[model samples]
Target: MRIIIKGGIWKNTEDEILKAAVSKYGKNQWARISSLLVRKSPKQCKARWYEWLDPSIKKTEWSKEEDEKLLHLAKLMPTQWRTIAPIVGRTPSQCLERYQKLLDEAEAKEGADLDLTGPTGGDAGPSADDVRRLRPGEIDPDPETKPARPDPVDMDEDEKEMLSEARARLANTQGKKAKRKAREKQLEEARRLASLQKRRELKAAGIELKGKKKKKGMDYNADIPFEKKPALGFYDTTEEKNRQIEPGFTNVHLHKLEGKRRSEINEEKRKKKQKTDSEGGVGFVPARASQLNKLKQAEQISKRRKLLLPAPQVGENELEEIVKIGFAGENTKAVVGETDNVSSLSDYTPSSTGLPLRTPRLIGGSLQTPRTPLSVRSLRTPTTERARLNRRSQVVKRDLPRPVHVDELTIDDLTYEGSEIEKIIDLEMIKLLKHDAIVYPVHGSKLNSQNLESIESFEEFTDELMNQAREAINAEIKITANESDLPEDWPKFEDLTGIKQCQNQLEINRNLMIKDASRAAKLEKKLNITLGGYLVCYKVSRSSALVKKTLESFEEVEQAKIELDSFQSLNLSEKVAIPKRIETLQNEVDHLVRREHELQERYATLLNQKQEIQLRIEDLFAKTNGNA
Candidate 1:
């Protein structure tokens, strides 16, 4: 006996079967309906229908109002997604996903504001994206909510059997009662035939027979049961006693056995309908008997599908020259290339060109970033030859933008550079380190490994050290990883795919400083290019003081500039120093100006927020008063 997991993305056959089952069993009776499908359960069927397959579900773009309403409702009801789902006109999963996406976007924007986006380029971490996007390897919990992939051309034996069984079960028109009645009628006929045969046999031997009288129930041969007596009319009493007349079988035609063929009836109806119409029933183009008839025919044609003719063996240049010579009225010779067997193609394509006709032509791009280098624990096995057989369908992805790196962010991960949180964390780590040093003095003692063998020879020292080690082991130190310099070191990972993940960190290269400097230089050049002269000016101002006072200046131009009277002889040294002093002052002025602008902006933002909060409170109070 084998146990199999039933749920995943649905295939075309399953979808079609589900639709048929739903039609027969109705929207309710899911348990009974589920019996028709081998893989899907009752709950999954119900969810698949309601979440995606149901006609009522909206799959269009969410409007501005819907987004606003969703956000407002989310704020009011927090994690009550199921309750909010109906109001939002979305499935619970959709509502929850959308809410999470919105929150991620907001957090990303906030991180950008705090100058913590990108790797070392003021980028805090990976930006927000559809984090809930399905990855390969792992099964989708709600495949019912996604579109079904088409079934392969060659289906399994089990699938065919399930399809046939479903067809037969759904096709049965008679109910339980109808079947029982038919069975009883058959039994009665059999009994009548048996009795008739027995009588014939007895009569043939010249034996007299009497029929048994019924003690209970009606005797059909004698009289009708539960008959109502008709009231006698004065003139109709003699006629009522007369024998009833039956239709003559001699006059009945073969066609009259079943009056009016269905085709004839339909023809008459169509003729009548035509007579009634001003220009017949159909439009300019003749109407199809059913909608999508052409489409159905085309689909049938596609199932057998045509293949494009393989490329002909010919010399293209020679052919062209021959055609040109023929046009020029000169005798030309044709050169045909030798042909090879095309039965086994190395690859498949519509035309026998290198690429397929259906494949999209990729326009070459102007710029591309180099792939990031990654650190691996060890080398993996190289991939083998590509598979020629059909592969599993790719998981459906959302239309949302894909982020470069998939990062697992936490509250402690992306705080402000000089924030209180950072300061507190640093302080806590230092404290933990100190405590570890004191309590676990074994670590400090191990720094002097030369004393290890000789320590036991000194019995008094050994006893003291052993006692301290025991005390350290007994010490109940309650500390978290954040509160200690020594990390748990459980190897962080980037959740890339469902099964495979990348290490969050890269391996340290030998020329680490060189690589770092190169990347920094490239990043600086890019920033300068994108941001313009303002950043360059700011950087120049900051580094100007250092530039003016280099080691060479301390060696050569210590007092030379002041000795030559470039300006007035009076206070020449002060004059030379005045420019450098002015530059330093100018740098200070720039910083002060930037700081003042920031403070003003922050102050204004606070005032606006405060005003809005006040207004909201007043509105709430007024509403409460009105309700009371």
Candidate 2:
């Protein structure tokens, strides 16, 4: 990547500066260096850049003398600063600081101080043991009594080569074995992953290879026929085979069929009533059976009862029956009780029995009164229903088919425009002949149409009526009010509790105004007026209460400021001074408020006393006015 610097300097040049920062400080600290370089001067930035780059400078020239001295120091003392520093031409401290570590390897090699020459010194340089002598107070070497350590066996040329070759082979074999094991494991894992991928692919394609499903329509037999065969050796009889009728023979078929059906129905009914032989059918109880047979033979009994309607009972006191026949021979008659003698005197009597039944007897039947038929019954209606029927007939004869009256023409009756209106009016008039039908009493069960229409018409015009009612109501209220005065105990507007309350409130206001001079002045100023000195002095009992208040407030504020200053002078985390002055001021304010409340209560009590005196004065005036 190219390092591009297009802006003002390294600080503004985002790309080049970042690259330099990364190269000098490694990629890890590049961000921090770039941030610092953004604000630092270019000289400071260049110095930091040079310091980071200078330590890692590589010198490619071979220092042959330095190498020879380095190897020489690797022998001799092997780890001594004094023996290694001169050979490197550096300080003893620098030798120990930088390269004394290079001399330390000689202590690990066997025969480390032995000169590599023949038994005596041949051409090898001086051994470390023969190099120097020490002065007094320096420790001398003890040689004669020292035990000689055995020399390590030296490797020949071929053996050294073999050892080198073995080490190389071992390293190569271990590396290859590790790589081979990793490759085998990777191959095994890849094969496992491939198997899983194959399973997923098959699952995605919806293939169930392990078990195949059966196709539809293959499980059952479809060719079986459904027919019933005749029983062996069975054949149709001649009646069943040849008794078939031709078509269009409905009457013949029905007549032939009904005869057999009637016999079957009678057989079914008889079977339903059958009794066992032991349980006394006709053969077991012949005597009782003959009695029943004699009754059936001597009397002709009918299963169905004849229906007879009683004559209509109309008048209770009158004896004559009003028999009115319609033009079509439809007779309407009113009869009383069970007597038919009047009908017998008429021309409608039967010749066989000389009875006057309503209809003539049948051709072969006689008009005989059967004394004992299926049952006997009495006259069933009560006296009250009979009386009500008599009254109902009177109403019907008086009101039926009547014309309407003019007073009874409702809005619904007015729907027709011309002749129908006259018809409805005539019908209404006919309906009104009975006094009970025309006028309904207020206590009656119902009102007639005239009364209902009059009521509805009165309600329809109620707006002016309501106004008149309101005027009458006001007049009555005024008269009632003028006839009586207010009770003696009732309060007047001026003497009521509201006036007393207002006086008490004004007194409280005055007391509150005087309780604290400064507060009173503030209240007065807020109310935009000045309290006279006399009132202030009379209320607070001091001419300089305002001054005192001002001084107190100033002192409080000064004390607060001083305390704040002291608190701020101390450490920020430290506590404030104890609030002794503020507590004292708060206690004083509470006491003043309590005094204000007490004064207010006293003022209210005085105001109540004044109100009582005024009430007594008003009562005396009322008594004088009444007596006069």
Candidate 3:
């Protein structure tokens, strides 16, 4: 039989029993221990021993060395607390907790130390311990501080080996340094000699070296002698004296300047013409002028050539003019000019008013008809001729039958015989005909009938049934209300306080069950009455009640927990009103401080005045004593 150790705090007897069982059965054999103990399971027994009963587990404050070791181990193996726990002589959970605490402290310290805008305005630098841990090759850049070298006597084996290697390196570097010094000396001598040669060359060439020339005196205008210097004035007249004076240059009119420039240009052209005439006109003329003269000669030659060419011959029909007479009877006649045989239109001359002379001609026995005037509407219909022409040229459109649908049958229509139709009857139709014989009346046929008495009787029956159901439901509701009513003995759940009180009562009941079971076990041992036989069942029921009460109270506890978490997580101002109020208090403090300082100064002044008065009074007393 499994003995469930329900909701009871561990007692000394239980602890002793667990310890003995653990000792006898070993730590890992929790199932055997649980069986031996009879009141705890493997999980419960293990938790009891490790959490509270274990003597090896330390619950004391962690030492500095232990903390350092834990931190180092944590850095070496992060999150593996079980590995570090043994080395630190603590449980894994304790080690993890201590490490977290240390880390938080270090972070806070770092934050406080690293204030960029604080009084120091800079970091205080690393700690002395960190500096001491620096390697030999790494040196602080501060001039006052020197890199630490390990003493041979104090050095470990590794350090000694490093020192020997460093000494060898130093020796090699010294040799290289001496060679480098010799090379540098040679280079310096070469540079000195070259610079001397360069200076000699410059001096031979009479070139002065560029550098700052020293002034005779510190005064800015020391070059000007005191006696010969002009009077000090804001504007200098030296620039005016330096300007050139041209005769009749300033006040010349713009028109006169333009006329003078034109005359000068004419004189230049006349001189050029004289020079050309003196040279017998064989001097260069512009290529464009020569080309123009040649073009004119070529044009005159082309005109002579065109005049020498014969005129084209005209046909008789083309030369003959056809003229129609309006009232004269038609008699064709050809009129020829006396000077020219063919009187062309080009040869005809118009009068001075630019009007042409109209002459009538007779045609072959017919009268000419006058042209009719065009209508405005005919001019507006621009597309009429085009549309008519298009319509005349268009092909005629004939109606073509559309293709018939594929489902439409092309076979000839024929009437079917009755015998053939009968042979082709549908299965569904036959089934329906067979079903018609056994078919019952339509649904609700009786209800649809106009029998008022029967309808009233049915409604009365439904009303009676509804009333009976309502009464039954009302009785059931009353019974349930009575059953659900809280007894006077039952605990209240109105508030967190009442719920907490109920939780406490449930805990007490659990404790009582544990006590009673223990007592019953003792009684069973003393007598053979089997008193503890029912205790298990009783304990189970009590545990269930306790669990139910705990679960019920859990909601309140959870709410409180959430509130606590929210309170803890609140920022500085929400958590407390101090920060905002502190500003006002700080202002008051500053005001008080300023007032105190002013009062101090005033008191000092008053003290000085009192001293002066006291001295006067002493002097007066002395004089009065002297007179007396």
Candidate 4:
């Protein structure tokens, strides 16, 4: 079965040849060539041989020489990285990363100089200053040139004089107090002159003006249109200017004359219109025809409807039983009474007394209940029998799906609720019991271990058999209950694809046991199979799921115990110190947040105050200038 790895024809059969070759080969040679086609599955064997070849494979040791070389080359020429990367067989980026790491290490060293004083410095050498000074009124100045403007304060005397004049002119023209005073004086003078002129004009015209007839200023013809009124069927030829009417008796007399003339003209036009309409003979015919048709239809509908009878004029107490259901016509009452005459089809007429239709009455000496259909009565027998049987079965058989550990033994024997014995059972036992029973029933204080062991074995079998029994029992129970049942949707754990996980775990546990056994037998002159260790090993073998769970539980218990011990081990002051520290931190944070809010509020208030003060100062300056 010998085979050389490279040349094909000279080798033995592929799998057999590989197995033989691996057996003969040295460990170092096997590691490098394991990927080649082999006689048998070579991964594990090849790995084992490779591990044998290099004892350091168990714990790989880093070489100081290689580490130093990488570090030196990395730091020497970091920017020109590709030049030195080939020495270490890495890319430029990798070299750069290594250089950064070396830089970090150099920084961490107590007295090491980070300034890599090498033949070539790296990219982080000297930085150019990125700031520039601005000239007056100049933005984005050229880096190579000097700025071109002098500062405003350095202006010549002429410019300063011009600026002062501009400011003075602006102050005089825009000042509010000066402008208001000037406007008030102008208005007073204009009003006095206007009143005097009006008095002079009224005296010259020999007319007395009342308060409502006082004249406005002499802008006469300011509101009239630029056209003269027509006179006697002829338009005026002259381009007349607009004229304003004076508020006096003269204007009132003129308006009254115009109104009287217009009224006379309208009366004459109306007389002509009435004469023409009488001759035309085509008015109101369309409107009257529609009105007559609507009246006729209303008359026909009224005649077809029956009139309701009027109610008897009686007091409220006299008409107690005779209910007035509705009024007929405008004021008539329609009443219904038990003895009132009404049409009846089958010797039983609906009562007019407003009682319920279904209420039985002693009519013609006969009593009858409302008839029910036959179909409804016939459908009840099977349903009621089924319900009664279900209730009886439920009374006889009442069991809930419980956890395997708790369910395996009955309440009288094992304690249904969490008693002492129930606590001892593992959680995995609970999970298993959820699938099916884990133990047979037992009695007495002396527990029967044999049957319990058998039942445990039965619990661990593939779920196909146990599920069948469960399905049958469920079907039977559903039948007894006469109710449709829900189907199980979750996968059975034993039916799941990952059971290989449990097998792998078991294999690892067996290997560990074998190794420990061998070590004990060799070291202490003790046999590999002791009763105590063997029992523990047997427990592991019996339920790998449970053993794994138990180990995790023990770890958690140990952690909890450690935490409890640490709590118990605390000194009195130390325990109290934590809460005090926390309180101090919370108070500090609260104070800081309050201070931050206060500062923000103060900043806002100060900004508003500053603006208000600026406005007030501006107003004061304005008033001072106006006075000056």
Model 2 ranges off by over 4 Å: 1-167, 175-187, 207-628
lDDT of 3 at 101: 71
User: Worst 10-residue stretch by lDDT in candidate 2?
Assistant: 142-151
Task: Give the top-scoring candidate (lDDT).
Answer: 1
Misplaced by over 4 Å in model 4 are: 1-138, 141-154, 173-178, 181-274, 277-584, 590-628
Ranking by lDDT: 1, 3, 4, 2
Worst ten-residue run, lDDT, model 3?
A: 402-411
Best by TM-score: 1
The digit string of per-residue lDDT tens for model 3 on 184-258 reads 999999998998788789989998676466766656465544557657878877999999899789999897876
How would you encode candidate 4's per-residue C-alpha lDDT over 1-628 as one tens digit per residue? 7553332121222323334444444444554334443321345435333322223332222245556877777567656766875676544445554566555556546334654543434654432121223446765322111112333436556445644553443343335676789899999999989998998899899987665655665545665545586567866655454555555656356657566676888998999998876566458756666777889989999887797989869978756534532222112312432333322111222446874667475677665665557432323356556754453212133554332224344333421357565665544354344323322222222334443654454334334655687799899987786333323423444345346455645876899899999987687654444455886778668798787899999999999999988878686668879999999999999998899789779989998999999999999989998999
lDDT of each: 0.67, 0.53, 0.59, 0.53
**Candidate 4 RMSD to the correct structure:** 46.5
Off by over 4 Å in 3: 1-13, 36-39, 50-52, 111-628
Summarize candidate 2's per-residue lDDT along 475-577 as a digit string, tens digits: 9987787423565545574366567556756875787667777786777786644556556567565646877988999999999999999877784534343
lDDT of each residue in 1-628, candidate 1, tens digit only: 8675677788878888888888767899999878877888899999988887778788875766788989999999989988888999988778876777778878878878998665756543434453455557767777887889979868988789999999899787568987999999999999999999999999999986998775786668987878998777756568767867666866888899889999999999999887767355457334544545888987889897678898887889978976775654322112322234331212222345574345343468443443345431222223211221112111112223221221222334322356787776665443333333332333213223423333333222243565686577566454332544444332322223312322222322435667999999999999879888776588777688688778667767746766655555667778789999999999999998899789779989998999999999999989998999
Could you estimate the TM-score for every candidate?
0.27, 0.11, 0.17, 0.14
